[model samples]
Target: MPRVEFGMKTESGEEFTINGELTDDELLTITNFVQSAEKLLECRLVQCGNFLPKKITWNQVSGFDICEVNEIDFEALFACLHLSRPFILQKEPWSYNSVSGILGRVFSHHSEVKRELKGLRKIYSDGALSYYFDISIQEKSIFDESRFLSWLNSYQYHRDQDKSVLYDELKSSFSENGAHHIMLIRLHGKLQAIEQLTHLCKVIIKSSAKQS
Candidate 1:
């Protein structure tokens, strides 16, 4: 293997220089970046968290969990997807809601998060979040068991004394906010891979300089 010097200059007049071969410290930085990225990539909210070593079936396919979802949480989840397509989540233009714009689907000034997105269903005609973000419910989801029970508690669904009574309090307190859509999954527990990985790439860039 050969080693050489690397160098570059940004349009902002910032310049960077490095060696073609990774130093011991640089190797550790790259290892951290790669491992962190791999962990984030493996962080999937599945229909089943644990599974047997046998082939699994698709029966568990159900709608989508835990901490109150926030703005950065969405960003972390979105970055993990490495979306090949553009997905600018916004209030439907047809929606007469007083508010408008990207991420407006999640937050609201005039009302609660749920109310801001009330009556949003994913039917063919309905331009719900599903209309724009059409991933499989099994592969990814925006609903959870708590909401399911809430729906069951509603007269519209069912409220069996054995099943619905116990969770009634939880149901009442569980805000119908759509935060559970992506759940509260922080990538590698708040590891910012884009910035760190971009840094590692800089450290690992092959040098064009010839060895002396």
Candidate 2:
């Protein structure tokens, strides 16, 4: 087992680390959580974010360092796992007039997602921290600046490919911190690639405590 170390901090400012090989179950739990978050991104849940809760509840699960924190900024927690810290957590709201207005425009074609949500079903995560976070949503994303910026890079690319999409006019969604997103994406990719490889190979992940 390759040694993995996590730097954890509590809401009250206590910090500690859990460094070791993860049990099979702990690795599986974290894997599932991440998958869910990725699915949300693919589904374009970022457009439906206004309905997301401002605050979410969290409880530590089977593993990781024993940090007695209640309100770890969901974004920051995962940012560490990605090998960097996000300087900003709060994002600019989407420019649509209302949540539904954008959701309708965005998902009008994907009637299946709407119908299924009405029917009650849970999606899988590619990176959902739900195992540790009770509820991380579109409004309060689990992505650090790197991940979000990476998504935006894709979005802008696709938008340029197809300008006729109804929800393509979401420019107002960027916060003042948006300027640094592109820089983060380019540099962060170097850090993230090695992490995925760690799943299948004996890779030593590097860590730094620069982030919250």
Q: What is the lDDT of residue 82 in candidate 1?
A: 36
Model 2, residue 174: distance off in Å is 37
Clash-forming residue pairs, model 1: 64-143, 142-181
Candidate 1 residue spans exceeding 4 A from truth: 1-5, 11-26, 42-202, 205-212
Name the best candidate (by TM-score): 1
lDDT per residue as tens, model 2, 121-149: 11111122322443223444333333343
TM-score of each: 0.24, 0.22
Per-residue error for 42 in candidate 1, Å, reads: 6.0
Per-model clash counts, in order, read 2, 13
lDDT of 1 by residue, 15-60 (tens): 6553434344443433444444454435442212221112211223
